[model samples]
Target: MATADAALRDTFTLQGVTAVQPRRPDGGFDWDWRGPRNDPEWAWFFNRHLVFTDLLAAYQQTGDVRYRDRILVTLDDWIAQHPAPSGITFSAAWRPLEAARRVMESWIPIYAALRDDPAAFPPERRARFVASIRDHALHLRNHHAFSGNHLITEMLALTRLGLTFSDLPDAAGWRSYALDRLARAYEDQVYPDGAHKELSSHYQRVVALNYQELLDLLRASGQEEAVREWEPRVHRLWDYFAAIMKPDGTNPLNNDSDTESVAALLRQYAPHIRIPEQTVRLPWAGQVIFRSRAAAAADAAGVRGSGFGVQGSANAAAANNAKPRTRNPKPAAATPPPLLYAFFDTGPRGTDHDHADFLHVSLSVGASDFLVDNGRYTYTPGAFRDYFAGPSGHNVLLLDGLGPDQGPRAVTAAADAAGVQGSGFRVQGSDSRFPSPAGNPKPETLNPEPAASAAPAVEIAWGDTTFASASRPAFAANPRAADWRRLVAHVPGRAWIVVDRVITFSPATLTTLWHWSPECTVEPVPGQPDSLIVSRSSATLHVRHAASQPVPADRQQITARSRPSPQGWYSPRFNMLEPASCTQLDQAIRAPLVNVWLFSPAALPGASIRISADHRIVVQLDPATSLTLDPEAPGKSAVTGTMR
Candidate 1:
C-alpha cells in the first residue's frame, strides 16, 4: 500500500475556492447561502443539492486538504439537520438526499487514496463519511426518489459503493438492482417520441449531466458493454433538448423550469455530445419539432476534435479518468423537417392537471410560434390562479366576465372533453360553438347556456401536404367581443386554420376582420355606433351596425373615458352622422387604418382593387390589417397582410 505522501500525489489545488461566497477560505460552502425559500421544500432541497455538489467538486478537484476537511464538517452539519431515522429526510417531495448519497459515494476515490495512511486522519472522521454514504443510499432507496429525477445518480451511488467495498455481500446484489432500475427508468421516463416529461431545457441539461457521470463511472469500471448499450439513449435525450429549443434560443417553459445553471451545463456538455439536428415530433408533449438529433449522435458516438462534441468529451474524460475510450462515432443526423403544429384545448377551465384551456390553441410554423397560448406565470395559487387560468391569458372568450363555471373563483374545473393526437402535434377537440348571426336579429346579445358545448370536433389530414376540416357549429366566439354590446367589454378569441382556404359554408353572421398591428388596439370609431377600428401603427376600421339599420340602442352606449393604445388614445368620440353608414361588410377584405407614415397623418386609403393576370379579382386589406376573406362568401379573391 502507498504511504500518505504517495496517496496525496494526485491531489490538485483549487483556485476559485477563495472567491466563492458563503464559503470559508478553509472550504465549507453554505447550502442555503443564496436566499430564503419561496418554492416547495422539495424544490428548495433540489437547489441546495446543486450548491453542495459544486462545493464538493471544488474540494475533490483542488485536492486542497482544507476542502476535504470542510466537506466533512458540512456533511456532519447536513446529517445532523436531516437525520435519516426521522423518515422526514426522504419524505414528501425532497430530492437533495438522492444527490447527497451520490456525492458521498464519489468520495470513495479520495478515501481509497488515504485508506492506508492511518497517521493522516483520525479513525472516527473516516468512519463517519463512510457510514454517511450507506445511510444516505438506504434513505434514497426507501424514498423512491432515486429513479424519478433521472436514475443516473442512484446508479452511480450503487456502482461506486460496489467498487469501493468488494467485501460487502450485499454490494453485488445492489449493483444488479441499480443497473436494472436505470434501464427501466430510461425506457419509462423518455416519451414515445423522446421528449422529456418535465419539458424544461434546464431539466434536460440536468439529466445529461447525470448521464455523463454514470457513463464515466461505467467506463472506468471496464463496463464498456453497458456503456455502449446506453450510448443511443443518452444521445436521444440531448437530441430532445436540441429539438425543443426555440428560434429565439429560449425553450418554452412547459413543465418545471429552472433557467439558472442551464447555460453552464450546456457549455460543459454540448461539445462532447453534439446532438444531431433531426426533427422529432411529439404531438403529445407539445413539442412540434426537435432538431438536435445530430448533436445527440455526436455526443453518443464520443466524437472528439473540432466540434462542441469534442469539448464535452474532453471535459468528461478530465472530470473522471475511470472511463475507457471507445471508438464508436455517431454519424451525422438527417436535416430537420419544416414542422408546423397547432395546439387545441378541450379541457374546461384548465385547473385540472391536464387542463386550463377549453378552446385554446397555439400554432407554430417551424420554430416561430404565430398564435400562442400564454404559458404559466405563477406556480402557487395551485396552478389555477387568475393570470394562468383566465381568458385574457388564452385565445378564448371571457363570456361577459362569466367564464367557464368552475367550482370557485379561485378554483377551475379540469374538463378535457376531447383532444387530437398525432405524430408532431396535438389539438383539443372543442364543443365550443356559437350560432350564425344571419337569422338572429339580436346576434350581439349576451346569452348564457350552462349546458352548452363551445368546442367542435374537427378532422385533420396530412399527406403530401396537410389540410384540416371542421364543420361549423351553431355558435362561435366573436373575434371582437365588446363590439356586440355597448359598455360590455369585448374579449378577442382566435381559432387556427391550416388549409389554403377557410370556407364558412354558411353565410356567417357577425363581422369578421383580419387584424394586423403589433400592438393590437381595437376601439369604436368615434360617433360611429356600428363601426370600430383597431390599429398597431395604423387603425382597423369597423362598422358594427348602420344608423339606417334598427340596432339595439340599449347595447350601444358610448364610454365616458378613453383607453390608451399603442398608436394613440380613444376618447368619447361620436360619429358625425346620427347613425353612421354601418354597411354590412361581406366578401370584403378590410384593412385596419394606418397613419400613412410618421409624417403622414393621412389615414390608409382603401386597398386598390386589382384583377390578377389569371383573371382573379384581388382586394387587398390595409397593411395594418391581417384580414381573412369572408369564408362564408366562397370563390371571392380576398387577401390581408399584417406587418411582422
Candidate 2:
C-alpha cells in the first residue's frame, strides 16, 4: 500500500529505475516523463498502468477511498495526456505490446472495479476509457511481432477485449481475427513437446501464462467447445515447464531468459494436466532435462526403462503386468542424496531470442547452480549483450569465432568472430523472416521443421541417464569452418559427460567455455592442469577436460570479471549485471579435435577414459560401472549409454 501511495504521489520506480514525475501548472502529472535513464523499458512499464491495478487491489483490501480516488485522478490524467497512436509505432507511450498489456493486465480490471461507481467513474470518463480500448484494439490488429512470443501476447489482449466488450460494433471481428491468429501463432511458437519455440524459459512462462489466462476466460464464460480445443496445449506448455524445473522449483536461465515463479504457474493448471513426473526428453524440441532417480528405490518401485537411462529389456517384458506400485512402494532412506539436474540445449537457435549457445548445458546440484548460462544482459545490443549471447556466456565449445579476447561484438557480428551462426536449431525465421499468415507461403524458412508442432521426427533416447546429441554443419560461407558434433549424457545424481568433436576441413581455431555460478570459486587441482575443483556453498564439483590429444598450457585461462578482451559476467535479471568466473580453453584444430568434459562430485583417483578407432568414448566410472558414448548423426536420437 505504501508503494501504491507513492505511485499516487507521482513518485515511481519501475524496472530498477526511479524518478518523480513532474507536476504541471495545474498540478497534473506528466504522463510522458521517462525516468532519468530514459530507458524505453521504463516508459513501457509506466504506460502499462499496472500501478492502477495495484491501487485498485489496495482499495479493495483496505476500503481506502484515497486509493480508489487515486485511480480516478491518475487514469483521467493519462487519458487526457496520451491520445490514440496514429499508426503502428514504438514511441515510449504506444508500443503495441505495452498497449495490449495495459488493457488486458491493467485497464480492464480497473474498469470492472470502478464501472458501478457513478460518482467515482462518471459516464464521460467511462466513455473515454471505452474509446481508448477501441483504439488499442485497432492498433493491435495490424501488429506483427518478429514471429516471436509477442505475437501471441498481442493477440491474447485483442481476444480478451473482444470477449469483454461483446456489444461493440467491431467486437465480433476482433474475436474472429484474434482467435485465428492466436491459434496459428500458438502453432508457430510452441513445439510438439510443449516447449516454447523461442527457447527462453522466461518467455515460456510468459506464453504459458497468457494461454492459461485465455483458457480460464473461456471456461468461465461457458466457451466449453473452445475450452476443449485449448486445454491440451495449455497442459503441454505447463508440462514442459515442470520438466525443466530445478530442485529449487525454478526454470534454468537458458537463452534470453530471466527467473520466474514456477509454482504460481502450476497452481493454476497442474491439476488439470496429469502426467507422471520423471526424467523427460523432448526430441522435437531437441532438449532433455534429466532427473536422476534413486537407483535402489527406483528399480524396486517398478521403474521401466525409457531408453534414456538403463535399458531394462533384458530383465522384463513389454507387458504392464508388473506388481502394482502401491504394493511395491519405494523404500525410505534416512538421508537422501541431493539429486543432480541438467538442462541440455541442442535444438534450434530460436527465432527472436537467438543465442549462440548451441550444445549448451546447465547443471545444478540440489538448488545450487554450478554450470550456468549468464541469461541475457540486455536486448539493446552492446558489449554485454554480445558476451551474454555469444560463446562466452554458456558451457559449450566455441568454434573459430568469439575467443577469450574478442571484446565487444554484437550477436550478429559475433558470427564472424565465431563461425557458427544459426548453425544448430535451423531457425525458420531465416535472417529475421517470420512466417506469414496461413496462405502466404513465400515467407517460410528455407528448411522449416516438419510443419505443425508434433512429436519430433527424431526423438531423444529416454532413460535414467538420458542421452542427446547434435551436429552443427560447417559455417556455410567460411572456408575454415569445421563440422561440429556434441554428445552428452546426464547420469542423474551421478555425473555428466559431454563429448565434443569438430571435423575441420581447413585450419580453424577453437575455444571451450565452462561457466560457473558467481558464488563458485574455481582453482586448478594440485598437480593437475587439466582439472579444476569448483566449490560453491558446502558442495564441491570436479571438472576435467581431456582431448583426443593434449592441449597446451598457455591456451587455458581463467577469466573472472576481466575487461575488454574476455567477458566474465552474469545477469540474474533483465537489466542487472554481475561479475562471474569462467573457464576457457583455446585450441588450434587442423584435422580434427574431440574434447571430453567429465563433471562429478569428485573424480576417481584412477578413473580412465579410452577413445576407440571408431571415435566412441568409453569411461570407466569404476571397475564395475562403465559408460560408452557413441556419436550419432545430427537430428537422430539413439541410446548410447550402458548405465542409467
Candidate 3:
C-alpha cells in the first residue's frame, strides 16, 4: 500500500534508486524517467515494468479505484508512446527481454486482474490492451535472447501469451513454436544430472521457476500429455537447486549468482519434494554437497531407523528441504544444529554465468556461511566488474595470475556481452557438460566444443566418501598447464579434506585463494602452524594446511576490501559490496606442488604427512580420515581415503 500510494504521488524506487516520477502538467506519466545514471543496469531494469505490478497488486488488495486508475493510465500511455516493433529509442522498453518480463511480470497479471473490470477496461480499451500484448509476443517471437536463462523465460512468457489468449488468431502458432523451442532448450540448457547449464544457482532458480510456470500453464491449458513428458526432467531441475543449497537456506555464490533463498518456497510443497542426501553429488555438473544434518545427533542419541535417506519429516519440507529430520523428537541434551554444509564446485565453467572459480568451495556451519564466493557484483563493467566475474573474485588457483583458459570469447570491456549470455560481465565458460544424445542438434553455437569432446572434469562414486576432480581446463592455456587435479572428501561426522596438486616443471608463481564470508572472523593460530580459526556467530571451523605440503611463512598474506585490487571483497548480491577475508598464498615453485587444506569440526590438530618424491601424498587428519593421493590417481579414484 505504501508503494502504491507512493506511485500515486509519482515516486518510485527500484534497484536502490529512488525518484519522484511526478505526473506531467497534463497528468500523463513520463516513461523516460531514468533514475541514478551512475549504474548502467538502472535503465535496463526500469524498462522491464516490474514496478507497475505493484500498483495492480495494491488495487486488488485495497479495492482502491485510484490505484486501479494509475495502472490503466500508465499502461495505456506507455503503449501509446511505444508502438509495436518500437524504433530504437532511449527508453529501451522494446528490448525483447524487457518485453518478455513486461508480458509475464506486468501485462499478464494486470490484465487478468482488471480485464473483467469494465469500468477500468472497457471494450475498446480492452481490445487495444490485448493487441499490445500480441505485439509484445510477436516482437518476442521474432527477436529473443540468443541463449541462456533469459531465453527460457522469454519462451515461457511467449507460450503463456499463446495459452492465456487462445482465442487470438496466432495464439496457437505462438504456443506451438515456443513449446518446441522450450523442449529443445531443456535438452541443451540442463545437464544429465539436472543442474542448469549456466551453473549459477541463481540463474538455475530463474530457469527452474520459468520452467515450472510453463508446466503449470501446460496443465491448466489442458495439455496433460505434455505435462507428463516434462514433469520428471522439470523435477530434476528442482532437485539440483535443493541439493546445492547451503545450510543457511541459500546456495553458494558459485558463478554469477545472488544470495537467493528458496527455502520458504520449497517448504510449501515439502511432502512432494525429494529429501536431499547427507552428501549429494551431481557428477555431470561436478558439484558435491558435503553436509551433515540431524544424522550426527541421531548417532549420538542412539536413535536408529530415523529414515535419514528416505522420506523427509515435516520440518524437512522447509529450508531447501536439504535434510530429512526425525518424526518423533527424543529429548536431546541441547538443540543440535546442522553441521558442515559445504558446496564444492569441482566442475567446468558453465555455458553462462561463468565465474573463474573452478575447484571453489563454499562452507556453512549451522546457519552461517563462514566461507563464501565473491558474488556477481553487477552486469555493468567498471570497478568490481572484471574482478567479480574473473578468477580473482573466486576461490581458485592462479599461475602467474593467469586463470582458467577463458578462451577468445571471454567477455571484454569493449564487447557488448548481451548476445553472449545476458551478462555483459566476464564469466567463466568453455564447458562441455554432458554429451548430446544421438539425433540432437548441438545445444548452443556459442559453445565451440561438442559436449562429448571435453574430458570429464571429475568422477564420483556415491558409495565412497572421497572423490577427485581434474581441472585440466584451469591449466589448459598456461605455460605449465600439464597438471591440475583436486580431491574432496567428507570424513563422515568429522572433517572435509581438499587436496590440490599442480605440476609445474618450469619455474612460475602459483597463487591459491580462499574467499571467506564477510561476517566471518578469521584469526591466525598463535604459532608457526599454518592454520586459522574461522568463526561466525557460534559456529567455528578449524582450517589448516598439511605440514608436509606447507605454505611458506613469507609467502602468505590476508587481504580485506583493498580498493586498489578487487581482492578481499564480496558481493551479497548485485550492486552490493562488502569486505571479506581472502587468504592468498603465493609460492614460487619449479617442481610439482601439492597443497592440502583440512577443515574440521574442532580446532585442527597437527596432522602427520608424508609426500614421496613422486608426489604421492599420505596425510592423516584423524584416525577416521586419513587419505593417500597418488599423482596418477584416475579421476574416479582421485583420493583413496581410510573410510573406503
Clashes in each model (backbone N, CA, C under 3 Å)?
A: 65, 11, 1
TM-score to native of every candidate shown: 0.47, 0.79, 0.80
RMSD of each: 17.7, 9.9, 8.9
- Residue-wise lDDT of candidate 2 within 236-326, one digit each (tens)? 7887766677756667887788876675566556744332223454444555565553232223232422211221111111122346558
Q: What's the candidate order when arranged by decreasing lDDT?
A: 2, 3, 1
Angstrom error at residue 274, model 1: 8.3
CA-RMSD of model 3: 8.9
Runs of candidate 3 exceeding 4 Å displacement: 21-34, 86-91, 293-337, 406-482, 547-562, 604-606, 623-625, 634-644
Better of 1 and 3 by lDDT: 3
> Please, what is the whole-model Cα lDDT of each candidate in the order they appear?
0.35, 0.65, 0.64
User: Best candidate per TM-score, number?
Assistant: 3
Model with the higher TM-score, candidate 1 or 2: 2
Worst 10 residues of 3 by lDDT: 460-469
Give one digit per residue, the lDDT tens place, for model 3 in 145-220.
Answer: 7688878988998998998888989999999999989999998778766678778888888888888888888888
